[model samples]
Target chain A: MKGASEWDRHAPSSAPNPRHTRYHPRWHRERIPIFWWVGHRRYTLFILRELTAVLVLYSGLLLLAQLVAIGRGPESYQAFQGWLAEPWVLALHTFVLLGLIFHTVTWLNLAPKALVLRVGKIRVPPRAVLVGHYLAWIAVSALVAGALVWVAG
Target chain B: MSPVAKGAGGRQGTEPERVTRSREPLLWSLFSAGGMASALVLPALAGVLWVAVPAGWVAAPEHGAMLAVAAHPLTRAAVSLLLILFFFHWAHRFRYTLYDGLQLYHLNLLIAVATYGIASALSALALWIVWTLG
Candidate 1:
């Protein structure tokens, strides 16, 4: 066998042989492109989370309008309903509802990461917060839906 | 600074001042969660409000309590405050939805401007209605 110095001088640390594996095939394949690697930027993520608030604002605005129309008179309120029932407005509302659902799911997922409230010395898990929010939303939604159905019945 | 250090020309880690409420993760999460909850609850409430008020099942309060508040100086100030905060909140949230949901990055700036502009206009309209009613 060659001495250490002699071996170091002649032998390559990275080998050319196929079995030697100077380059990893998996690593090369797994490497993400620069832009793709960014996935989504923080600013984008922040804005995405904020979509829920926008949805709330929009709903509030519409509700306020409905109230104002009712205040004006039944005819005006009926006219407002006619406008809302338009295909385009209904479509927009449907689209916004779907968006709100997505926003809710994402926001719930991030809640734990965003809030690390400790109950005494015990730290509350993020999942718990998410589940709580979802549960509350479901409960509130159900209550309103039930009331609507009851009234309609 | 090295290109590598600057996230390869991306924004630095520090959040912009206007958007920065604080770094408390719990508060941020709760706020976001609250926003989301409100998003869900408000729409459903709006539906109830829509049906009840029109069906004469429930009286619309905005015409009375809300309008009365609008008439008062203190309440008018409060209403304006709510409108502004709510508009900003809407803008802050819509900016994100547009950025992520729509793959139309080419139209990102337009979407941002439109979302915010519409929200501001709507808030203004709400204020206008309140003032007129009051």
Candidate 2:
């Protein structure tokens, strides 16, 4: 009994029952390949969408830094601007700009799916929903630009 | 073997399993909201700041003018919200990227906590800076 208890203690928990074992044909479940996104166009695009978050983070940090620079006075603000004027900074901005555009386009395309707008008994068409998003976007941008111009002038 | 025995054996061998529910829906909602907001505003913001100003396509606002905009109460509020949402947006995307891209679902709890914590901290810092700006 002592030896049996010791053996049980060292044995695997929930051992397979021999009585339950049967000759069942195993189904081959395909494992996800490492480059799964590369296999499909949509997958690649989805990955790119996921990637644009990095650019978003970058822009957020840049804006925060600019705010801090502004608070630090005119010399610091000018220094920040000078740093942004560097060629490498310009190149990085170009890539970030492209990423932001891709992010916006993909996001707009998905808006219709996520948003179900209805007026009374009528459901708004998907195309109309997309158009509304674009129009609103343009209006907001124009408002900001106008404000900036007004402040500057 | 009899039908009863065969059925018993099959039932013992393969029972339906319950899947664990994930607590990701809450984070996903913030991600969706942030994505929508950024989609609308970020492109234009990036266009003017990174493209037009840098390329000399538009006159860059003077430092004082830019400072005035930044110091405006409405501008500060909007920017703070935008930055916070953007950070959360990045946090959610990055968490999923790690989960699916690198197959880090085993560390889901840790990753979620860490990512959201960082985002919250950064958002607080950004808000403080924006609020305290003269």
Candidate 3:
């Protein structure tokens, strides 16, 4: 404990107390680059997953626009549908569909990680949780499809 | 649950400390629920509306038929719920993405308000549209 001034004796010492440098230097953290996610496959995919929210928001807005069109009258609806039938619109939607499907897959895969289900002290298997989500997806999709095609049609 | 009471209460007589309820769990629940809701429905809806019907892979429903479906109380409820959840999901994910990906922790309050405020506004718009849709 003698010679407490040893740290201050070193050149370029701004810290007044020897104890400061004796324990450690000033805390430093490396800055993260802006494009840190670039070129990293897993990270890229993760960003893509995050990016899918854009498509999801787009889809939500798109449907609301459709409903608004419907409310405006059959002519308005027809015109809206006409715009959708355009090749470019269909192409854009094709991309949207792919992105949303990817979202669904990743969501199902990650569901069990968040939802810990147990039945009387016996934890439900993660595989079962995943299977349950998939089955729910299929059922919901089937019902919506049937409603759109059969009931609504 | 406070850390002291949340964990197995091994300390002699430590009372459960009152914890401030954070909205995080609520937002997270919305995010996941929104994700699940959109996942289960968005593809079907978008595929049918955007791709299949528009592209003629599926015959376009009778004009009145689709409108009638949209007008239904049940369908309106579902649409409102889905749209609201979708925006919230987007808000939560995009907020975190902006924070971590862009390192905008310095603007945390601004980011949270902007993200969730936009989501809430859009949800109101969706509800209005759904309400007057009949």
TM-scores for chain A over all candidates: 0.61, 0.77, 0.82
lDDT of 3 by residue, B34-133 (tens): 9999999888878887999999878888778877889999889888888999999999999889977887765666678888999999999999899988
- For A16-114, candidate 3 gives per-residue lDDT tens digits of 332232455656999889789999999989989998999989998999998898888889989999999999988999999999999999999998998
Write down the lDDT of every candidate, Cα atoms only: 0.57, 0.80, 0.83
The local lDDT score (0 to 100) that residue A14 gets in candidate 2 is: 28
Which parts of model 3 have CA positions greater than 4 angstroms off? A1-26, B1-21
The fraction of reference interface contacts (C-alpha pairs within 8 A across chains A and B) present in each candidate is 0.30, 0.58, 0.69
Candidate 2: residue B109 lDDT (0-100):
60
**Cα-based RMSD of the predictions, in order?**
11.7, 8.6, 9.0
Q: Candidate 3: deviation at residue A110, Å?
A: 0.6
Alpha-carbon TM-score of each model against the true structure:
0.50, 0.80, 0.83
Number of the predicted model whose TM-score against the real structure is largest: 3
Backbone collision count in every prediction?
A: 6, 0, 0
Higher-DockQ candidate of 1 and 2 = 2
> What are the per-residue Cα lDDT tens digits for candidate 1 across B1-134?
32333332222222222123343353344345446545446546655554444444454343344334435776456545555555655665565555555444445546556765776687787777666653
- The better candidate by DockQ, 2 or 3, is 3
Q: Which 10-residue span in candidate 1 chain A carries the lowest summed lDDT?
A: A12-21
Q: Is candidate 1 or candidate 2 better by TM-score?
A: 2
